[model samples]
Target: MIGYVTIGTNDIEKSKAFWCDLLEELGASVVMDAGRIAFIGNGSEKAMLAVCTPYDENAPHPGNGAMVAIDPGSKEMVEKLYARALELGATSDGEPGQRIPDMFYGAYFKDPDGNKACFYQFA
Candidate 1:
């Protein structure tokens, strides 16, 4: 199973701020802050998302074909989180809607740092 996912960021503070604000609505907060890295989620025991500067010190770049998908629990919350991501400076990759009739409803976007994510729900 997955414990967490770390997205590389050139601007640690900016990335942390963006994620903190966006995930706050889901009761997730900064569970740990170790200077260049910050983990956000409900608790350390649960899966969390980490925004950090690359350890090798190279400029952070989004990896092609990699994405983080979050299940917000309902179609409405998927819509809400998608919109919130945009409001927080994410660029739309896909709009909110069903991807497979009644089976999946999702939205996609790239964060300010260009990390792709999906907010989705399954019926």
Candidate 2:
């Protein structure tokens, strides 16, 4: 029941670089680039990720505990995405591993803007 998510950004270009490079690997691309750019997943325009400077013109601040949970499609994909995020300068919130054995497998990290995020698979 989710359509899209918008992450606040103070520097649009920096945030654009982050999301573009990252989401493009997951099959999304820049579909909207007006005031706020949004990356829409291939074959689904309804679900998108966007970055925008606050309308009030204040510095963008990441909300604590808010995250965009991603599904990279497999355990291997999860591992790869987690590692790639770190390589691109994202801080680790938690390393790649099982959060609950035989149940929930998860990995966590903070994006460049310090937004908490994760990808997981059912084990």
Candidate 3:
């Protein structure tokens, strides 16, 4: 019962480049673009990820304790994407590893705009 998740950015173009390049690994592309806002994903049937400028026109900031979690289908993918995010200028929040005993493997990072995200897989 989930639709899409929106992340605020002060630099829409930079965020777009970062997200589009990173998400392309999963075959997600810019399905919609409205100048100040853009949506990236496979299609409407799957949850989409959107990056947008704040409607209020003030500087955008990441919300405390909010995060977007993505399942990239495997532990290897998590590791690969986590490293890729860092290479794309994301700062590390957590390294790729099993978060729960033989159950959840994940990696975490904060995008250039400070939006938190996770890539994970269930083992």
Candidate 4:
């Protein structure tokens, strides 16, 4: 139902670094940047992640039960991406594991501003 997703960040460079690393680790490539926005996607260029700058001083942080789930190909790939997120300064919300008792294999992490995000591979 959604055509695109964009998350606001206080520090664009930091957020960009975190996402650039995570996306590359997941085999996606960073494709465009127009000073205020950045886009990342698979080699086919689907335009998945959109990092945007906050428009107002009181704008809410990106994550608050909201999440963006990406297909990282395999369970191991998901795990690695999760770890890399942490290494790039994301905080842990949930560890890598099965979510639906063998139906969903996933991991949850937060961006620098505490936006809840996850990567999953269906089992």
The candidate that wins on lDDT is 3
Pick the winner on lDDT between candidates 3 and 4.
3
Task: Compute the lDDT for candidate 2.
Answer: 0.79
Report lDDT (CA) for all predictions: 0.93, 0.79, 0.94, 0.79
**Model 2, stretches more than 4 Å misplaced?**
none
Clashing pairs in 1: none
Question: Which scores better on lDDT, 1 or 2?
Answer: 1
The residue-level lDDT of candidate 3 at 104 comes to: 94
Kindly give the stretch of ten consecutive residues in candidate 4 with the minimal lDDT sum: 38-47
- Give the TM-scores of the predictions, in the order they appear: 0.97, 0.89, 0.97, 0.87
Please write out the lDDT profile of model 2 over residues 1-123, one tens digit for every residue: 777888887677787777777766787777777765545455444677778888788887888778888888889989998888888878999888988989888889887887788888887
- Candidate 1, residues 19-86, lDDT tens digits: the string is 99988889998999999899999998999999999999999999999999999888889999899999
Colliding residue pairs in candidate 3: none
Whichever of 3 and 4 has more TM-score, that candidate is: 3
Which residue pairs collide in model 4, if any?
Answer: 63-115
Best-to-worst ranking by lDDT: 3, 1, 4, 2
